[model samples]
Target: MGLWDDLKMQYRMGGITQRLIFWNIGVFLVSLIFYEFRLGTFIFPDWLALSSDPLVLAIHPWTLLTYAFLHSGFLHLLFNMLVLNYAGMLFLTFFKEKQLVGLYILSAIFSGIIFCGAYFLMGRVSIIVGASAAIMAILVAATTYSPHMPIRLLLIGRVQLWHMTAVILIIDLMQLMIENTGGHISHLAGAFFGFTYIKLLQTGTDLSKIVTGTVDGVLRMFKPSQPKPFKKVHRNYNTQPRSTTASKTAVKDKKQQQIDEILDKISRSGYDSLTQQEKDFLFNAGK
Candidate 1:
């Protein structure tokens, strides 16, 4: 297949991680068209970037999440996308794709709020843009869930997940007071949110649901209403006998029972435990 065709295929088949990366890269490219390259840096407008001033944020509230999709430079976009791909994939292995998306969005907003609050308290004004906060949240959330999971690194061999997470957190901590303090603060805020997310999840509280539910509600509000298909009522003189209808009902009940058994098995031991015959049956039933 051609390059564009291949990318479309991948997008159709791949999970949320791939889609998120696509969105970040797509935004970066679109931003380039309007970006003014001054002093070898891409300067985004205040409407797009998250500003520390409460008034600016109040006026441009969307920046809390929009800023996460933006980057100040090519290298900034490249590194964040790389980390997002890695961390998002790891997160998916343990959680649903919806949860991963919800976490990414919620974390970015949480971090942005913290960034603004910190800056406001210090009586300083600044603007920030990048997906580092969201990406860091994904990485740390995955690490929190499976800290003992082994990961192999080039030249460094296999290490536990927490080890990798700690290194990143330590680096952020070390840089907290030095350069780019606001960015580092946002990163740490995202990390904190990630850690909290996993903990609350363990206690049977899914924080991601808030974001997921809000988005779903908003979509429902804006989605066009579909007209119901008109059905004409007809009296059939040649109706099936009662015995035949009862037999069909029995057969349908039997099929539903089998489906329930397969679903229960999947919930207990996962879909991989199902036999090929059972898999085919389920797939056909779904269709």
Candidate 2:
């Protein structure tokens, strides 16, 4: 009904990818407003932007993550967000929302660490900004998960996943010698995380679980505790409904069987072959 109400609804229903984009854009706009009002750039960005100096990073460890949501310029923000939207949609097609969040955060952190290391070696202190590292992770993660998947590139027609990755790698590699060497290195670091994330997953290990658990633990700390309701002092002898272990086993077996069947279908006909209901079932099971 209203702007705030519409935003709440969108946040409630929108996928994690869209929410991440919104957050980045919101921060970028706020930064711009502050700049426009002669607030000067030194105040906000200096606190949040990732720095190559180990001393600065040690003092403000949170900058490793905060920098991913900041941008130095409008074009910088636009390019990164565009890539994020594109890659995020592709990544979400086959992975859970939690996985996306984990990969993004982890990759950005890895990138920041590597960037800091590079600059430290060069004996220089440079503040890094932008979401390029995180966006690279999303793009590479999707490409790793489904290397054969087709994507339409302008003037290039339909191209395979590896092709896109190769081109990106080449561009990043080339740019390393030209300018922003740390940024290019960070992109490569993020790409490494994306590739490894899928490889480890294929071996039945999920890094997302760790990220999810940590998030839940922190959320619990901030969440207000609800008061307990009054309970009856007297006990009744009425029997409760019986839920047999056998029935529970049967239910679990059925769900697993369905999941197996859906996965088999995907392997044979690709992810697009599944019906809407089947897709939702698989997605929920992932959660």
Per-candidate TM vs. native? Answer: 0.79, 0.74
Best by lDDT: 1
Residue pairs clashing in model 1 are none
Candidate 2: pairs in clash = none
Candidate 2: regions farther than 4 A off? 2-4, 33-44, 224-287
lDDT per residue (tens digit) for residues 97-169 in model 1: 9899889999999999999999999999999999999989989999988999999988999999999899999
Worst 10 residues of 1 by lDDT: 5-14
> Model 2: how far is 207 from its true place, Å?
1.7
TM-score of 1: 0.79
